[model samples]
Target: RFMCDYDEAGSIGKRYRRQDEIGTPYCVTFDFDSAEDGCVTVRDRDSMQQERVPMDQLADYIAARIQF
Candidate 1:
């Protein structure tokens, strides 16, 4: 599953921790950089690693990386 998290402070680490404690698989963060470039930050629940994803290829990237 995928969802957008627009919490206060734009703290990806904090959000990841909260979601991790609750067992969320993934969280997508849309920041100011996205407005500048068509991309977003995707955090891996288990690894806590983030990577930039172009908006145009986001769907494909997720489909290829996440298996449900």
Candidate 2:
């Protein structure tokens, strides 16, 4: 699940779908602000809801939401 430096050859939306079809629970994207601001965009699979969370606290944040 470590894709911080992942910049594949496709639109981000396309990448999201690829993850979705494969049953990825969430997709965390790192951008310019990620390193500087210490935040990431976390997108949920079932609801497609997204949120910004501090990178330092990401693990705890996701863990809280995972049902199992």
Candidate 3:
């Protein structure tokens, strides 16, 4: 659902900012226990609110947030 071009020095925070500037929406990080947790930190680029939501419920969550 997304794509990126990497810069060697790019930090995760900086990368998120770049995606925000480009009008992209969500980001998912795959850590060791991401699947087990069944939730991930989702950031609202416009509001910068990082919310932890269940992975199995991600589609529903994002669908609820979709603007008009």
Candidate 4:
């Protein structure tokens, strides 16, 4: 199983920064549009690249890249 954390106490930037400081491999963000689009923003900590991934496929998408 994968460990997940829910954090919404600060701004998105702050949240990203916090995760970056801890060397998180990826960060998934569900914003207002996610409810309608069923997509979440997946950010790569190393590349600082962001992509939209459908909620249903999120797990597989991350699993494909994660090396745990």
Best by lDDT: 4
Off by over 4 Å in 2: 1-7
lDDT of 3 by residue, 9-59 (tens): 467788788778887677655445677887777778778888888888877
Clash pairs, model 3 backbone: 38-55
**Compared with the true structure, what per-residue lDDT tens digits does model 2 show for residues 1-68?**
33333546698899899888988888888877888988999999899999999988998888898776
lDDT against true structure, model 1: 0.78
Candidate 1's residue-wise lDDT over 1-68, tens digit each?
Answer: 46654556536677777878887766777889899998988888888788999988888887898777
Which runs in model 1 stand beyond 4 Å of their true positions? 1-10
lDDT values, one for every candidate: 0.78, 0.84, 0.71, 0.93
TM-score of 3: 0.71
Candidate 3 Cα errors over 4 Å, as ranges:
1-9, 32-35
Q: Judged by TM-score, which candidate is best?
A: 4
lDDT of 3 at 58: 76
Q: In model 3, which range of ten residues has the least summed lDDT?
A: 1-10
Which has the higher lDDT value, candidate number 3 or candidate number 4? 4
Error of 3 at 62 (Å): 0.3
Give all TM-scores, in the order shown.
Answer: 0.74, 0.82, 0.71, 0.94
- Count: clashes, candidate 2: 0
RMSD of each predicted structure: 2.5, 2.9, 3.5, 0.8
Task: Tell me how far candidate 3 lies from the true structure as C-alpha RMSD in angstroms.
Answer: 3.5
